[model samples]
Target chain A: MKKSFAILATTATLACVLANGTAQAGATLDAVKKKGFIQCGVSDGLPGFSYADDKGKFSGIDVDVCRAAAAALFGDAGKVKYTPLTAKERFTALQSGEIDVLSRNTTWTSTRDSALGLNFTGITYYDGQGFMVNKKLGVKSAKELDGATVCIQAGTTTELNLSDYFRANNMKYTPVTYDKSDESAKSLETGRCDVLTSDQSQLYAQRIKLATPDDFVVLPEVISKEPLGPAVRHGDDEWFDIVKWTLFAMVNTEEMGIDSKNVDEKLKSDNPDVKRLLGVEGDKGKDLGLPNDWVVQIVKQVGNYGEVFERNVGQGSPLKIERGLNALWSQGGLQYAPPVR
Target chain B: MADQQGGVAKPPFWNDPTIRSVAFQIIALCVVVGIGYYLFHNTQTNLQQRGIASGFGFLQNPAGFGIIQHLIPYNESDTYGRVFVVGLLNTLLVSVLGILLATFLGFVIGVARLSRNWLVAKLAMVYIEIFRNIPLLLQIFFWYFAVLRNVPSPRQSLELGDAVFLNIRGFYLPAPVFQPGFWVVPLTLLVGVIATVVVRRWAHRRQEMTGQPFHAFYAGLGLMLGLPLLAFALAGFPLAWDYPVLQGFNFQGGFVIIPELAALLFALSIYTAAFIAEIVRSGIQAVSHGQTEAAYSLGLKPGQTLRLVIIPQAMRVIIPPLTSQYLNLAKNSSLAAAIAYPDLVSIFAGTVLNQTGQAIEVIAMTMAVYLTVSLSISLLMNWYNRRAALMER
Candidate 1:
């Protein structure tokens, strides 16, 4: 016990030195560059958002966000290591500098941004709390969910949303919460619960993995706005700007009809807007502390935002979630990015 | 030769053993305390520098999640403080229940292990070896997953006399609802309890002073039961049991024991009882064989010899280690978080800490609660040990 305490004290002391004793500006980026990689935190196993395959390789939009950031910084997408964290452990991992960027499907909330010493870079996926019920139950909607036994995943916004929806409708229900989503799904499959509540995309993702996927149906109700994003620690504005703009750069490339396939050809085009963005007429990466070809490396390596989505959660993936709220602003969606130039 | 003969003279203060020992202790204490203070201050400064809020104010904010089981009233809009209370109560409920069940089962197995019957002893031995060797978490998973398998879903519940129901969701029994003037029944019951105690004492006095035996057992039992029955008759049977009815998706209006609680209770008691059985067996064996022989020579029955002579003496050896086992059971009850029992560690340290981002404060409070609980158990066992101590004087 004494030895563990001594070790803990030494660690805390080292953490203090790293947090305050080092050169006060751009420390995270400097450390990342020195360490030769960026430590990125993602979900433990959220399907299509960071779940690992049988080969232990992680794929999803969240993982791509980190790869895009890494490619922009080091020009090598592989120069990033993944740390999968649970919902409860994600914020602390980011705040403690255990990971440089928390690209997990974490919702951007006011309390988390202001109080937890975290600054959300930008929303990567717009999600909402939804329910998945067995088809045999014949429950039509969330309103008809009165007196239902709802299985919810702990440490997420779904639990709170379920409670609120039930209370608002003057209904009573039992919430059987579990730490892992798989456990909740198992309970639902066994008829232990009448409803399984989670983000809509997650419901679809979990549905396909069920023993009989056709038995479950995702409800149409979208209860709460969960703008999932990547977050950086509070002190490093330079690092924060890099992380934020990496995502915006991807979205802007999508809006401008550029992708990994046509990026080299687009460099030869005469469009002034594209020229300034691609560092042909103007260098857009200097202020953000990057090289002139950072955007080019990102596009070449990670593709545009739409491609990431389609490859991970869109038609190319098993989830096949539509980009309803995630399309570009020109397409009358919520995904609007500021002009690059 | 003269100095050796006169060596009993008082030594100088600096060279004295007492003074030197005291000095070393003071130095050691200062170093320990200084390290503790440095660690605490360093944590506060680091937390502040990192801009994470560091205070107990978050506990007053609303806890926006729901718990599956709460012994008291709870709502989603309640404060985090209420959440802590709910989690603490659930933890205590599980720990206390587990301890009681483990003690009972442990004593039974422990005594049976020493039985002359070969099959019974071997059965007890097998049970100990099987349960003690397996990990408690896996056992919990096994019980929770495989439990209620034969029981159908809520739509096809197994009913008991049209008042109780058992299904996949839980086991539900009729909940007792008291109507107007129900207090009269309880008040009469309490009166009967007091009367039974007084009658037992008087009977004991008569047996001792007049050399005549009284059937205080039957008299006490009669007063305890007959008075309650009489009160119910006079008060027009003011108690009613509300039966559980099948509702939209589950049963409603019943006292339901959720599967999580049942699975947790089974795992905790069965696992802890294995260790406790060994402790109890050793305790009973520690008592000399001569005591049993002497009791038998004095014309005592085998049952009396075991309970009156063996158990009383065995308690002295049992209690100290028994306290440790009880503490283990209580601390291990935190594993309830695994299967969603809404215990203190999960609800308070997990969900509350996540929502508020007060890891340090939440952890400190959780550790303090466990320490308080363990210490309370230790103190209680110590008191009992003192009473059961041998009176050598």
Candidate 2:
């Protein structure tokens, strides 16, 4: 009997190993529920993307993604505890299970998705690497900025991109990397470095925080594709589905013209797509192990993708970034979500 | 036989001190092993469950990053293994510079504290009290942000005959573009240095055997300097200066010292020198005053008294504590990460770990490097300590 039981256990383990994606299916979800909150990893400070005020309140597009995930699980956006991480510390924090979802402004890369054992749910923000220079330097183009000292944030894709760009262009540069965005910006402001390079959106976000934002100009050169997204650890398919669908639900609702302020009104709509997205007609959340009103909860709490974007990083906010590539597919943008049903 | 009285008895097995102690050690050993095994097993299981990659395999992967300071040549396409070496070299470079500067400054301030002039001793006292009390990172910020950041931009660089320039970007000095046969200078210098050491040793032996004095300092200095000068003339001046020139955004084709390196070096040396100065002072004071007086009464001048009697005895007290200061300075060099100095902790443990996501392996490797550096320092200092220890025939 003991031998038979051991054999059964070994076969079960083998099955789990074979079906790698289903390994520890509901482990994170159960742990998160038992702890009564989602552990959301975010950036320490990047104004429109993720920043915490002195009151310890976090507000950004990344924070809203975490909030949507929390609302889907616990029906309350407040059921999340934020752990602000530096760029270097974000992935390790997620892998160690110190946080359930890394909603920081982490770029989606092939190496990160495959080798690092992370699954990027979706791209929440589309960005590109760019350069920002002090206007006094008269650096009109990146090509003319060769042999310059550039302050960059450490542990970022921008560093590699900068290196590749310079090497490809046959130009020489000195990269002085900093741990925080503000520090890099400050270096540029203080004349210690000739330019600051980061994602163009981040360059704008960092620009407004400077003492004289108007004195700096972002060079008109988009160097690399940066699809900033949220990521979760590999395995735990059930948890992965829930976090992933949370963002997609927002996108789907936005496509159906449902938002946080109009979510209740939309729940009473007779349109099939709207009803399905609001979780009124279809049990959209059943397979993901969430309640039927999961979509409703998310839409009511964190708003749809366009609403969150506008409020945080888009025209409604200080960053004034246009919803170009991040807009809906029908509007000639890249944010296209699958049908709810 | 008489001492072996019948009334005397051996303790019971439980009460046997040796047996009890051995059993206790065995139990403690099991506990330690059990804890270590549990942690290792737990980590293995967790990593497998998360599908996170583990092991030293990532070191072979491309580092995919550029560093500002690479002591050896480096490229972005270099493997993580090379990044580790580059980072280790930078850390060693800064630590060596800081150690040399701190030792010199510390020795000067230490002796000055014992000067007959009241103002000199008080000023040294103030310096030690102020610098050692503050933190090292703050001083690094002060140097990088407050001081170096205020330097003029490259367009408005302060230049010395256009060969050297000071700018916000960095301190640019003319790089030596070595032509054919420039290696002779360094070769001659090396040979002169070795010859000087041999001559000094011979001079000391002769003085001990026949009480005949030799001016070894003047002779050795002349040999060391004169040989290098002669080699330069014979080599036909096989060196050219690649002076920095104003380019588009910055000076080009020159040797540069980025402010990050300068700030970290200054902060580390100044901060550690304060502690080392106090140690030197205490070590000197630990020697008896009678040693100096005895040398003076034996017809020794003040310089000879210090060189022959006081310093040798003081070194015995100084070496042990000075070893700790050296270790502290080396370990404290990790704070260069705060200001982007491309030290071991920043490049390998910071960017490399982030890129690879192999936290356990990368961190363990970094910690191992620091441990090896500290252990080697302790071993060298202890050897020197033993040599300076008192000996009797």
Candidate 3:
């Protein structure tokens, strides 16, 4: 009986191996063009990053990044399809070729970049971990939360940062974790936890979901640097360059004082830099295996970096987060782009 | 007898059934092993090419995440190896409690379904049908998200006398704080158990020899209860109960069972009991009516008929399927990931796997745990099944 059982187990294991044997490699660009749609991965429902409206239309800064990619490829921003993934599912989805570009609010860490077989293009949002607490707790600072219970989302850098901060300060805390951001926020609202911790941008996004958003305040302590960006699979360098340069063009357009409303007029400008960026005086787009008009399409359809950020997560939207660290290098921020020439 | 009969001396080795069977088995074994090696080789190459680590070294790294409920000592500074152990223990904790509760509830409801009273039987049937039809994941969500969320907060908790409190967070029960001289209580209990066993054996032999019944049940009960109480009085009751009190935003000074754990336990037991009830009911029904009638004809009471004749036979049919239900309950506890309960799947497979980016190693370890647990349960149940088998001449 034992021998037969061993035989059966061996056979089952062999069958599983055969079933999972297919490995996709290094043709994402061709595949995307053939399918005529970019398979983009986004967060499930993180407002200001990736969220859907009541009619099921996805709109966020990350969503606009995918739109820009779609416009660069097909001259149509609506040709991209979005697949909402949880924090735990995003990496595996990219590794298995289930999604072409992972534009979810994922942090770029050294370990992930080196070990996860993925390449992050550029920073889309500069965020840092922060804490939000109920005002009724009468806590002025995070140091007062020594013995508090905190609500945190699992499978994110925020969890690790919270642990490090508490341990460094010689404080003890109880963490009640949830699979989704909104669930953790709900737990906080229901008084199950005294504090909620996440990226400062996400704290604002989640706070708005509460019945009384005004009752809670984000603590004034930014704990860790979180450079959120879009990532792609590792084997295709051509696809990598396209995604990387697409982001740079957006930033460069913003640096040159270009917006969606003024893009048409700038196309006729005599300025050498504007002409080169608008793809009228250079072959930089052609060098990246795209048409010379690619940048024009992206700028016309998805707008510049400032326009997308403001409309989705800044002064034009409900989040109203300041562009403190996301402004261009000319404006004394870290967002500098190489010249288009 | 040494050779073959009624033919040429024995078929050649190639044509012999024994030789043919051996050859086929050898070929099959070789094929399976070859495929296994090929798969392993391919995985190694893929991992190297992708630059992902493919070893167990990550187990030594600090976990840096907190688990809400851990049976063993754990902190954020502990290693991933410790986290894995904590996760395994929590999984076993839920599975064991769920199995015990489900079995007890299953037996009661199964018997209630067979009751002669119309309302009792109908009620049991309704419960069985309702829970059995719904998906287990949906039930877990309903309990964790809907029911627990509606409970009152800690400051306004529903107090159960002065010993227990219930709220949105969970139940807080008074915990016993043992003093230095508390060893005498367990010692006395052990002595009482040994005395009961000796008395029961003596009574059994006495009844067998002289056909005079002995009251072993009452005598055993007295020793078990009276000895403990007497020991407690002699030892000055070296224990104190610490009740939970509202402190700031939550309760303190007692054993608090978190809402996640409670919701998971409640959902698992209730869902598993429905299927176990069906197994138990069918097992009892499988026993023939003739056995009960024969016991009745021998002037046996209804209780004696059930204890002596009906139950032993019913257990033979019940134990096999009942083992499967227990295994199912244990595996279903993995669904605790959906509700963020920090079971083995949530902490190790979900969080740890994401952090390390080592999918192959993490998943293999997780699968190995489940496989080992299942095999152990099967081995134990099979032993009991063999002992309970009917002997024949």
Candidate 4:
């Protein structure tokens, strides 16, 4: 017993020393600059959010957000690396400085914003909680899903929204929850659950992963609002601003009718708004501690917000999700950005 | 020689053994306290810097989520305290069931390994070797992902005699619903148990004093079983079974065990049983052969010699390691998180911790739980070990 105690004491002391040596807290921007790359947290393998292809190249709306941030900072979108995190690890990863930014399709909630020391930059996808069921089940709407078995991902807003929706409708259901969305989708596919509930965008993303994607149909009832966006740690306001404006620049460029394909040609235009946005007439980037051409770099490298959305998850992608609430405000939707000048 | 002859002066304080021992103990205590304080300080600073709340007040907040399996009545409207209880009860349920099943299977396999029949021994050896070699997590995955996933869907469930059904979702068994007068059965069973204990003591005393045997086992079994059955019949069989019927999407009106729970239970019990079997075999073998021979020389039958001689001695060797195995199985139930079994670690530590961002409170509570369980098991086993230990003059 004495010998074991001695060994345990030694191990504990060693562990303490190692832990103290590794924990170096500082400004996130300084760390990112020193490392010469931004470590962005992303989803493990959500298809239209942040999935890696067969050769390990990540391309999604969230991935593009990270790329846009990298472009604004270093003028090279390739200078960003991805750290895939699950729903449970995303916040802790950012708080620990393990990742510079989190673009993992996380929802913005008042509790998360104020309580968890996180700041959601801007909305990338406007979504709502929806249900998906097998065609053979003959369940056309969520109201008809009384006493149904539902598969949901734990530790997510979707789970809470699902509970609230069912309770409000005076319906009863059994929830079979999984830690990963993929597993929940698989459970739905195998008929272990009668319905799968999540954000509408995620349902579309997960549906295509099924063995027979055509066998399942997403129900029309959207139950709760879900504004998904990128987030950053709270203390580093400068880093937060940079990440936030990178997204804003994308939105503003799209609103200005300038995209990656025409950004270079639009720079030569005589429009004062275009001149001011492209850094020819104003110094909007100076206030942000960035280069005058930061917006130009983001637009040139990562394209406008619409282009990224369409290419990754919108009409041009396999998900084919319509831009219902995510369209620009002038075009009858909620996505509106502040003018650069 | 001169100092010894002169009645040696007192040793210096630094050189004194008593002083040195006390000093060393004091230093050890200080070190432990220092380290603990340092960790606490670091955690407080980190939590403050991160702006995460540090308290147990979150437990009173509504959970706002649904749990598939709960021992008591629960809903999304329940508080996080209820969720904690639900998670803890589910954990205890799995651990208790796993321990009972593992112990029984372990003893059978252990005895089979020592059987004189070559085939029986070889088969037991092969089973132990295979299960013990594979990792427990992989076995859980194999059972959940490979085996359970391939089972038929609810529409094409594998039915057994219109009573139970198996499908990819879960297993459905008849649930017993008892009427008001069902209390008589339990009351009779309790009486039978007390009577059995009294009879056992009387039989033991009679055998010790008069050297005569009593069939206490038969008497106890008859009383226990017959009394409950008689009471049940007298009450006009006030128990009914609720059988599952094929509903819209799944089975309705039955007791359902989710596939995750089933897979976790099977994996944990099967994996732990292999190690337990080895421990039991070694323990039995550790008993000297001379004792068995001595019993045989006394004209004791084989069964009597084995039970009255071997088992009593082997228990001394078997119990300490057996306690460890039971504790291990309890701790390993945390792996249920991987398969979504809604155990304490998954629901409270994993999901609740993530949602509330109260890492310190949640983790401390979880650690406290495991520590309490381990210490309790050790305390109980230690008491049993003390009684079973060899008494020396």
TM-score of 2: 0.93
Residue B44 error, candidate 3, Å? 2.1
Candidate 2 true-interface contact recovery = 0.53
Query: Runs in model 3 with CA error above 4 Å?
Result: A1-24, B1-27
TM-score of chain A of 1: 0.91
* lDDT (Cα, tens digit) per residue for candidate 2, span A40-126: 999989998889989989999999999999899999999999999988788889887889999998999998987788999998998
lDDT of each: 0.88, 0.89, 0.88, 0.89
For each model in turn, which proportion of the native inter-chain contacts is also found? 0.50, 0.53, 0.37, 0.43
- Per-prediction count of colliding residue pairs? 0, 0, 0, 0
What's model 3's TM-score?
Answer: 0.92
* Candidate 1: CAPRI quality band: acceptable
lDDT, residue B18, candidate 4: 90
Q: Whose lDDT is higher: candidate 1's or candidate 2's?
A: 2
Docking class of 3: acceptable
Which candidate ranks first by DockQ, i.e. highest?
A: 1
Model 3 clash pairs are none
**How far in Å is the alpha carbon of B307 misplaced in model 1?**
1.1
**Which residue runs does candidate 4 get wrong by more than 4 Å?**
A1-25, B1-35
After aligning candidate 1 to the native by TM-score, how far in Å is the CA of A26 from where it should be?
9.9
Error of 3 at A242 (Å): 1.6
lDDT of 4 at B307: 89
Q: Considering only N, C-alpha and C atoms within 3 Å, which residue pairs clash in candidate 4?
A: none
lDDT of 2 at A7: 58
